[model samples]
Target chain A: MNPYHILNKLLCEEEELTSEERKAFVEGLKSDPELVRVFTGWLQVHSHLMERLPETKDLILYSLAADGHADDLTHQEASYISDHWKDIDSVVESHPGFKDLTHQIAQDRQDFLDCWGSETASVPQVFRLPAWSYQIAAVIAVLAVAAFATIFLVNYQDRSMQLAIATPGEYQRILLPDSSIAHLSGPATLEYNSERFGRSVQLTGQAFFEISHRPKQFIVRTNEAMVQVLGTRFGMRSGNDMTQVILESGRVQVASNETPPRSIVLAPGQMTDVVKGEAPTPSIDVNIEDELRWTGFVFLRNTPMRKAAVLLSSSRNVNIDVDPLLMRESVTGTFSPDIPIQEVLDALTLTLNAQVIEDEDGFRIVPLFP
Target chain B: MAASKFDPQLVLRAKKGDERSRNVLLERLSVVLERFFKRKIGDQALVDDLIQCTLLRVHSGLIALKHPDKFKAFAMKAALFELHDYYRGRHSMKERSFEPELLPEKNYSINQSSGDSMDVEKALELLKPRTRRILELREHGYKYREIADILNISETAVKMQVKRAFEKMKTIFAD
Candidate 1:
């Protein structure tokens, strides 16, 4: 029998197993190692699913218990909790490991009540009218009218304060009225308004901008540095000392083009870095996509380790820890953020001999290559 | 039954200082809770701790519930109160015998307790107090929205707490 069939049989738990059928199923599993692996994997997945949900069986038991007052599950009358507890005496009585902990959790209910009960006061009645006051209903009518009028006159008035969030590895395409395309990366945020307002955007974290080739100047501001491009296809990265600009197309000069800003002419495949308070460096050949991975692409032609890892972390919406010494280690390879974090970590480990440790949020990388 | 009968919109509205809404909402959720618990507990003495409290908590903290779509999960969280409370009562008495027919026998081996017990315990300990409480609620199969109401926190927070708790657990287990 195939693994899927075996898994289905296991799940359904039907069809009495004859001696011949049992032998055949085991024989089939043994004969094909690949099938056995799949079968075991399915079994493991089921086990996890079961563990993921603890009280389902108890819920079923509750449903079958056929008690009348217990039927009102909405009210915690102590009837249901008593019967459906996952760890009963039978399960924990002999197991010394679970006995103390189970009892501790059980006994702690009083403690929770002591803390929580004090704060749970009755809801106070809001402003009220006379018991039969006609004005009470009339007031509601007036408020409704005012709310509708305000909504009709000015739509929501909330674009300024609302923060947009994107899930990991998901891309949000924001289109400005001026025909500018912004591919916003997950785990990064940028706030902006229409061109009529200021034609400026406040970018706190990392993002890519293919600014519309417009008459007015387009500016992107970060804490470390600012990049002003007019109708250009380029990526500017700024944060701390790691300010960089990778020009892909169009002709645009950076602001206050001083030696410190590192004004450098670049062709198709060059990237420049302007360290905070330092001059911008000369053009060096690099992968535009890798440098701009937060915006779109993953592989860098030649990228710093920390930058690459940050891109992967942004893609996964995970915080990663990296030792300071490993930030400068150069890498020339490709990584797909859409791929599993494990696979990406494996690539870094096997290729660079780095050690990755798990944290509550994500992973930390320590350099072992040296 | 019609889904709207327990539709979360009415319940939340009542929780936020509306009396009529509260009565209507409570009445609706009561149906599901009653059916679920009546079958599970088989004891009237415990119903109040199991079902009544979840409803009351949901009623009192309805302001915290944002998503009506997650009502089922919230109800499940509310159910956890009874389970945890029941365990607590049992702990006080050191009573071991329960509705024993449901337990899986082989998992009761002596050696099994020492290894898995400490790992689960520490992970439970590391959780934020609210998360620890919520996990206990969730483990007992309380509805997600009910948990939100009882904790007076957002559903999103509950989700993040669970995810963080599990991640911490995975690390501890691995270690």
Candidate 2:
């Protein structure tokens, strides 16, 4: 047999050669540099291609596995599987890459099917849209009616359209239709028109808004004020006849809800307050990370030990004390709220080179030597 | 974040210019691409860059895709293209010198560590466009018979093209 023929058979894994042919092929490779070069080049391409492209048969197997061997298989796919069942079984058993690919593809298929539901196959009929079309048309009609009903209900409910709420002691993350995120600290409610979601929202209590950018303004209304932004992130708290707005990044306009609606523009790291009947207070530069710490992210920007203790105490509801000598020492780092308070304390004390003494009441920071 | 599944409906919606759906699809594709690249290349930073590039390619080419159900195949091809680009770029940057003395060493085993210097992309460029396509289809896990069916050629012809392409690569690289 020609050496090139043997090389092709070996690379394609078409068939096992007889022992004599294998010996001749090995001897040719050992003696012939030109043949070896051809073999090497072909082998490299084959291996890389195998790594990059999934086999067609494996894709079919994957589809079968993904769809759970249901009646959903196409006639072609069903036939292909039947014809190659033996080869497919052997490959799945022996080829780890194909096995992994099949598993991954099946998992991905299941995830999407769960997310979007299986595609509704249309039943063929003479001179008409498939049966799914009628089903879809009926669904659309019903949805139209339901939409009108929802609009009526919204009007009747006086715009109390509560879309999301976090009760006391609960922290909830709401993904708005516009892809904006609202991290609501408990005792908060976010409401907006279902039909006109992402344009604006009514926020009661404290929440952090990461508004997706758009040309139109996104408005957040509170009892005492309204915050308007094109695209930006900010934190808002409305309660006690007062509303506070703090901009983390981007820009926002805070206005009082009073007649004439006094407004002020706030830059990043600035905050403002609105009294029930007064215009929004002048924007003041503030530590946004510290102010928005309620959103479960601790931002310490050169925060003094004394101030850090106060902030941690209020946020964690634990009394923290710092020795006078260490009070002025500051620490800077961002900590996720998920970190245990003890771990945070250890980190803080480690930075200060101090020791934390835990007592029945709370934690006290003192010099390690002392 | 959980890996997002491939949804043909989402692809259709995105192709129809649904901004929200497009965003969702891109986000989901990112998750899937991240996993795919990470599995292929373990470097986190490189994987991230590959994911971004693949997502961009998918986004730009989505409207041109004729079949929504083939989104996985389309996205995977885009990913493979990007990956190949990376490999080619890395090889060129390294400027690996192929020593003539190493020609005989190639006979040792395809699994030899030095096999990385083969520069498969360069060798692939040596083939004719038709032959290259056949080889590509073969690489994509298509059988020789399937390639013949796809290209409307004979199976023996497909095998002949592949063999000739390998011979051409050997001639070019042996110099």
Candidate 3:
């Protein structure tokens, strides 16, 4: 078969090229630099066509609404929107018809509100996300930096201290050189020293532990506090200048590392927060289940897509762009953070009747039909 | 990694039996949920029923949600369950596919691009109408066989037309 035939198939269709064809294309691109240039050109043209293709827009809104199958072109558009919502105003502004469509949507949105009995009475028309949104985003960035710092700080230790790190939007499960299991949420790191049979773990960010009981007390050292336990279930969140330890089903002694240090014993269902330069405080009455919600699967009952995107973006470490216009739209469903980002995007796209465009960089969510 | 900014205050309020906050949260998600169901079922009447059912399920289960931070994922999970149930019901109807009872308005328009780098649009405009339709269908992720079925043409014919369209695009770009 002609190689261009295979290349054309890959370029034109939304479905992935067959593995055999993809491999052939890869080999061809490698051997034929001209083919690479042509492929790049085709990609550029394809992107432009994707933008201008009216069918792509129709399919994005109707394909799933009309049929359950999400079209690939629409998927690309959705991913683009998710990644580029901030830049979309320029795109929309340039499109002469989009202004009219936005108006129509705003008007129809009112009709949609009437059908739903004016939930608007409860939800304000506009929610100006406070300027601190960036500050909040910075916390995740700091936690990510801290994760790396923890690894570098432990560099002098036995080379056997295995590091398990989760970036934002990711989770890492480590079988400590001991039999204990550590579930690390992203922007978090867990360094296990196996030499002593997982006797010590340095944790930064949020992690859930179901430690195995051993004769020796397992020591967990964090920036603000040290948690010592024999064996039990607990979760610790240490970052952005505060350390919180929640004992879910075990007893733990948390000691602040501050000068004139203070310590507290926490029973199951107790929680404590320790800040820099302060001693660990007394355990507070709390719901253990709530403290450890991140350890389990996530189910959104009636979550604004804006909030969902924020939660999913931070957890998954993928940038999800929600159109400011569609920020108020809510999504209701059960989803596990453990699922592939594409699946989550697919569900969100299908659920919101939105379009998701995924380029090589990341995912974008476009909530409006236009 | 830990999520930096969860709506802890809003969540705390909802958890404390603040029905108003709960309503606010639900109302916030309503548009997204509506779009979700409308996308899958494409039936105006059924979308309302499914939304209510999903909301009722959320209401019953909301008290048990310990962390409001996970509400989005939790709600999405419920909507997904409802979606599965919808498919299951549609399947029991014995139709080959879940045909939409109503089609949404296709009012979104595409403007022709006019710029130095927008030659692709100009090239696209040059294709024959039937050829353009076939390419557009393919662009929308339809298989050649499906496009053939939709256009009342043979699968081989669809492939030939698509190939020809690619050749035309290449020629236009090469110029």
Give chain B TM-scores in order: 0.47, 0.52, 0.49
lDDT (tens digit, per residue) of candidate 2 on B45-112: 78789988988999998898777787765665567557645643542211012223334473445553
Clashing pairs in 2: none
Docking class of 3: incorrect
DockQ, cand. 1: 0.05
Q: Model 2: how large is the Cα RMSD against the reference?
A: 20.6
lDDT of 3 by residue, B1-175 (tens): 2321225566668778898887866666666677656534444577788888888877777787766765654565466556545533442211111112111212211223467346665676687766767655544344554455556554445655665676566667566
lDDT of 3 by residue, A58-80 (tens): 32232222222223123443465
TM-score of predicted structure 2:
0.42
Query: For each candidate, what TM-score against the reference?
Result: 0.28, 0.42, 0.28
Better of 2 and 3 by TM-score: 2
In model 1, how large is the Cα lDDT of residue B162? 54
Residue A40 C-alpha lDDT in model 3: 46
Residue B114 miss distance in model 1 (angstroms): 16
The model with the greatest DockQ is 2
Estimate every model's Cα lDDT from 0 to 1: 0.52, 0.68, 0.61
Query: How does residue A174 of candidate 1 score in lDDT?
Result: 53
